[model samples]
Target: MDLDVAQVRAFVRTAEELHFGRAAATLGISQQALSKRIARLESLLRTPLFLRDGRGVSLTGAGQRFLRPARRTLEAADAAVASVTREERPLRVDVWGHLYAPTRTLAQVAGRAGTWVLGHGRDLPSVTDALLDGGVDVAFGRVHPPLRAGLTHRLVRLEPVDAVLGADHPLASEPSLRPDQLSSGVLWAPGPLDRLDFLHRFADRFGVRARTASVNLGLAHFLAGIAEDPRRFALLPADVPLPEVPGLRSVPLVDPTPLYAWSLLWRTGDGHPGLDRLTMACAAEARRSRWLEYDPARDWLPEPPPGSTAQVYPGSTPGGTRADAPAP
Candidate 1:
């Protein structure tokens, strides 16, 4: 064949993402060069490979016909080349401090995927570097890494992060808790980097008048205080079903803004098949579970500091860490 192996490899990637921009990024080539390679391949193969449109890109029949064999050939090439490079690279799943629950959930679901969730300690600059360098397959927390670089961004789920408090607390009965209601009280929160500053934007919206004091507060301490005193509170995803510690309740914020959102991420290059497959599986399962809060009236958990790492509630498994995990 007149076509080069790189061209064939580009064809395979382009077919999968169905976009030249993504295909080039994944292949780590200029889009113009990638296009020329495809064009050259079309000329050599004597067939139109793609149907480009203003909306996006798609494949022609000839391109579709070549897809499978091209993929197999390229994969085989990688396998052979990988023999020299094939070391058991640890799967470092990136997670910042704010994403404790999601990280835990991913660990549970990735039981069969040879997964290890690495806590990145909320440093996005270094974390983003690790991601692009293939040091970690995924990162699950708030990040504003520059776009237009090699990346594929996908919003996994926008959870309504909120604070859970005891029902006996004065603000618990209100339609939505105000910041001022929390200002006079202790807060359970994460470190400075993990704190959701956007939540403060609503302080003005709801006339709550609140601000974070101990920015380094951990989740474990936050929950401990809430568990010990009815007056203490902690900000959390409204969907989290905090386990019963002794006396606690979940309060939704009148604020519609999400405390923060988590995303599924990978390098701009062609993500490992296994990584994409596993991540998509976890995200789909997470969406399916909905992770709803059971009831605030149960009264089992206490508020602790944002630095809290202790499992306030056990989940629905035989050995769940959550004391409130559903009976097996």
Candidate 2:
């Protein structure tokens, strides 16, 4: 039987997410519409693909068996279309903040690949949308899990998260600090749900009472919030410039330190020659970068707090590394 590509796409996304709400949200469709599509797909096959209970849905046996073939079918279709329409275009990459490491690495790689440049997505959701819509070829950013169904990502850099504060702050003089030590200051955390979850998870691991102040403002305001008050601090990736402004300084966090993963992601089956070139550059670059030697025993932090309101990541295993690409 011929399967509708749209129905298969919905099925794959739903199976990967196992939550209609999240899957529907990612697909930009209503939950009821997604459910009807799933039901129709099941009707055509004469087999139930998922089993729904109070907790949520799980794939049925037939669904489990169909998963691989469905993925292959979608991939083949994407590749066929790309091959037919293959043309050279400047690859657009998404950049986050003043993270120079990724920028430098991308330049080093993409410079050899004719033309490519950094572009900005309005926000993380927009970045995901850009990737799905083929507006960008690759991205260097945080890879929040239950990732969009058709993309694959791997950690390119692992940097210890640090606290940024005014240099005159009492804690700023310390070379390194523990979570308990940071509890003294009010933490200025991002108001975005994903970022908030990460911050809370970080706080929970060390069992620290972080008096966090939510900031919906952009980075400038967020940093300014910390600078205005000596008792305020913000978490930042290590690569952010020290003394971001003249008065601010970044201090390392230790004694239950949690490393923030900076990842490189792209469409799963994208056969862009520029992407292939960049992948090679990435492999070469990873060999020289310090982040490649992550010791899970030393780097891994404790799980999220007992009563974490955040949704736990569905799959424990990250996507498989491609044979030609660098292992992240």
Candidate 3:
């Protein structure tokens, strides 16, 4: 059956809102018009997309199944339009933190092409979503649980993390930190729980409680936190070039130091001309730089402690038993 982009858009908007009046208002259409559009979509598919009742509207099984693919189609449509209309806009590469490796690589790629832009995600998950949604052509992030399918990433680097401490703090002068030494301070890692879960789980294994606070992935927040309280510490990537903050220091974590495995995430089937060129450039750059190949066998941090609060991912070593780590 032939598909209608208008009808598909109406269905997606309604599916998101789950309320006909709200969706219609957001779509700038009358309720009757919106209803007709959805009806046309249902007719094309020969299925009831939603179940309507006094309680409200809810997606039927068919609607639930169609929602994801429909969203992808809409995102693609938007991306295509933007690419054509916005000639002045440079292609964007999204990164979460202060990592320059991806930028450096993409800059080399852009030199061969045209101008490119650098975008930043609040955390790993957001950057991953942006890549999938076509908001950004490429991203630098950690390969962890619940990564979206149909996406591919290259292991660019394994970043040794540091314990950020206030300059006057007693342990600030220490050459490196151990989990035991950091236990006294409340370890404040930035970003949402999901993005930092690996660090949390690893720290839990060593009896250090790592707490997370949602903040913009920028240097301003990191410096402000340490300035407010000397005891506040954060786990940050060591390899990224960070501007020296007067009152803060980044010290390597020892005694089973945690590593942030960085990767270049991009949609596998996306065939943007720039992305294709960027991918080739990135591969050549990675080959020359000898980017670190993450080995699941030995690269994993110690397993989560028994009965840890967070969920342990499947195909992982729980409580120190060896298991094949998930492939990146």
Residue-by-residue lDDT tens digits, candidate 3, 116-199:
677745467777766765557777656665667868765444556677788877799998777678776766666554456655
Which stretches of candidate 1 lie above 4 Å from their native place?
1-90, 111-121, 144-148, 166-168, 173-189, 192-195, 202-205, 215-217, 225-232, 239-246, 254-259, 290-328
TM of each candidate vs. truth: 0.49, 0.60, 0.59
The TM-score measured for candidate 3 stands at 0.59
What candidate 3 gets wrong by more than 4 Å, as runs, is: 5-67, 71-109, 112-139, 146-149, 175-183, 191-195, 210-218, 239-245, 253-257, 267-276, 293-328
Top of the candidates by TM-score: 2
lDDT of model 3, residue 35: 100
Alpha carbon lDDT at 194, candidate 3: 49
- Preferred candidate (lDDT higher): 1 or 3: 3
lDDT of each: 0.56, 0.66, 0.65
Candidate 3, pairs of clashing residues: none
Judged by lDDT against the true structure, how good is candidate 2?
0.66
Identify the candidate with maximal lDDT.
2
- TM-score for predicted model 1 compared with the true structure: 0.49
Sort all candidates by TM-score, best to worst: 2, 3, 1
- Find the 10 residues in a row with the least total lDDT in model 2: 310-319
